[model samples]
Target: MTIDIRPDDLTSPEMAELIAVHAQTMLASSPPESCHFLPIDGLRQPSVSVWSMWEDGALIGCGALKELGNGGGEIKSMHTRAHLRGRGLGRLMLDHILSVAKARGYTDLWLETGSMDAFIPARRLYESYGFSYSGPFGEYAEDPNSVFMHLHF
Candidate 1:
């Protein structure tokens, strides 16, 4: 399948619905009290650029890049649709996002993923892309549910 990925308008109706679905999925995988899903409006901020991936005209996944200032960025809200998992789409999305970050002159890329079983795949993916475990960054602590990682680009 020819998957088309592009920068998206965060306020677009389709993108908004996609964000809602992603947030809901995050909540489903984690408890309400521990969930760190960012609301749609928070993701639509000026420093963040959201992107949507489509396969055969259907939304397959989405991700966002948040400028962390001083040549750094944080990857946020990366999710592939339920039906499209394990087809290497996740890797494709990761590669695209990292490329975008590099293109934007970001020298440091950091991310926060849950440390639960549900996040095992994410940790593996990040590791495959040279992201190593590090102390928690941003507003996170050393919680059992949070894994902190970073990659120097």
Candidate 2:
């Protein structure tokens, strides 16, 4: 598949569907209190940069990077369409976000994901990219259901 990853406007209809599906999937995997997904409005904030991956005019996946200032950035809203899972679409979107963060001069990248079985693949993917387990960063406090990871350059 020819996947094109590019910055996207969160208000677009395609993006709305992608984000909704992502939110639903996350909520299904973890309790509402433990899910930290950012809604579309939050992704549209000035500090966040969202991207959508498209192939043959279909939205395959999406991811976002939120600037935390002080040379730190956080990954948010990463999701691959249900039908496209296991096709490496998630990894592609992640690599795109990492490159963008580096281009923007971010010295570190951090992310929070669930500790449930449903999130194992995601944690593995991050680990493959050199992210190591880390303490809660930014505004996050310790949570039993949450796993925080970070990569420093």
- Local lDDT at 5 for model 2: 94
For model 1 the TM-score comes to 0.93
Q: After superposition, how far is residue 95 of candidate 2 from its true place, in Å?
A: 1.1
Alpha-carbon shift of residue 9 in model 2 (angstroms): 0.7
Residue-level error in angstroms, candidate 1, position 108: 0.8
lDDT of each: 0.86, 0.93
Q: Model 1 lDDT vs. the true structure?
A: 0.86
Instruction: Please give each candidate's TM-score.
Output: 0.93, 0.97
Name every residue pair that clashes in candidate 1: none
Clashes in model 2: which pairs?
A: none
Highest-lDDT candidate: 2
What is the total number of backbone clashes in candidate 2?
0
Return the TM-score for candidate 2, rounded to 2 decimals: 0.97
Model 2 lDDT per residue over 3-94, tens place: 89998987679889889999999999999999999999999899999999999999889999999999999999999988778999999999
| Cα misplacement distance, residue 46 of candidate 2 (Å) | 0.2
Collision count for each candidate, in order: 0, 0
